[model samples]
Target: MDVIVNAAASADGKLSSRRREQLAISGADDFARVDRLRAASDAVVVGVGTVLADDPHLTVKDDDLRSQRREDDRPGNPARVVVDSSGRTPTDAAILDDEATTYVCLSEAAPVDRRMALADHAELITAGEGRVDLLRAFATLQEEGLEQLMVEGGGELIFSLFEAGLVDELRLFVGPKIIGGRDAPTLADGEGFVSEFPTLELAAVDRLDDGVVLTWRVDDR
Candidate 1:
């Protein structure tokens, strides 16, 4: 399974802008690109924090795009995969309520009762925390037939993957508005957070009217 990072941030690197209440801050092109990325993947993933902050449907809603998502080659909306590291994902989340398939990647430490409850419909995988093992989770998903995985991260989960060298590609759309707060979250920790990320080679750079979109592959090798 290949992990792809798909996200949007403020020009100043804040994930949700300093306001943290409005999502309209994300430019049109960035939102479009995110949906396009979802159309191309087998699974769309988000961390628990994102679930709470943004109750996204994670489905392509555009009329034409809906058909495109249901084609033979790249058909059907991708399964919604949530990273609920501690089984803390709200049981009533829209992601779980929707008719589409849903999955929860949680830690082994999750209570047996909680695991049983979540397993009612959503598949639950015990990917431990701190040193949470993403490799095992990826292997499990691959065996289950998921190939391309797009991760729409919050913070911690993104940092973990980059630090673990599990992220293969990154696509970012940065809006121009400067929501300047001393403490705003960035795109997990791609290159300069927890530690210096393995240098990534730029793949594409396009400037949108009020934002910049960047694409990169981890090294040419």
Candidate 2:
């Protein structure tokens, strides 16, 4: 099982300059590739901010992909997981619906009542405090028969995972347009660029229809 991150950002490196929630600049082909990636993964994970801001269904909606996701259980769609340190995901969010098997990972400081409420709708895992412990999250998912986790994230999630050496592969789609926002978030933040992880190295690069794709691997060394 691997944790793969897929995302598109502006040439100037802002994923969303329009709003924190809106990815208004990605091209249609990027969307298709994203769908394909989702179709292939065993589970999809994201930070709570993405869940709260986007409220995405996280489903592969092409008719064939949809059918493939629903049949045979194991071969079907990936379960949905969210990293929610505060346990603040909305009760009405699509992840809470039973149609998608959902899991929420919370930090130790998250309140018991909130965990209980989430348990009413989804499986709850308590990781360490301040951030989600992705290693433990993966172990929990493995127990549920999920492999090949894809993380579609807000900035913090991506940075933390990269820092923790939990990421196996990273897929970045660089959109053609440049957004010169002063406060835009990078996939990794601040001195994060200065501090190298134990074994991260470039794997491959390709140009997509409207963006460039960069694939990286966190080597075991």
Per-residue CA lDDT of model 1 for 1-221, tens digit only, reads 68899877777777765545535556666677777778878888888778888777788766577687766555467888887766777677888865578889887777777778778769887776643477787777788788999998876778877877778999888886677676566777434554464788899998875878899987732
How far out, in Å, is residue 83 in model 1? Answer: 1.4
Supply candidate 1's per-residue lDDT for 189. 43
Q: Give one digit per residue, the lDDT tens place, for model 2 in 27-94.
A: 77778889989888888888888888889888776768867766755545678999998899998998
Candidate 2: regions farther than 4 A off: 70-75, 190-193, 197-200
Worst 10 residues of 1 by lDDT: 189-198
TM-score on alpha carbons, each prediction: 0.89, 0.89
Clashing pairs in model 2?
Answer: 69-77
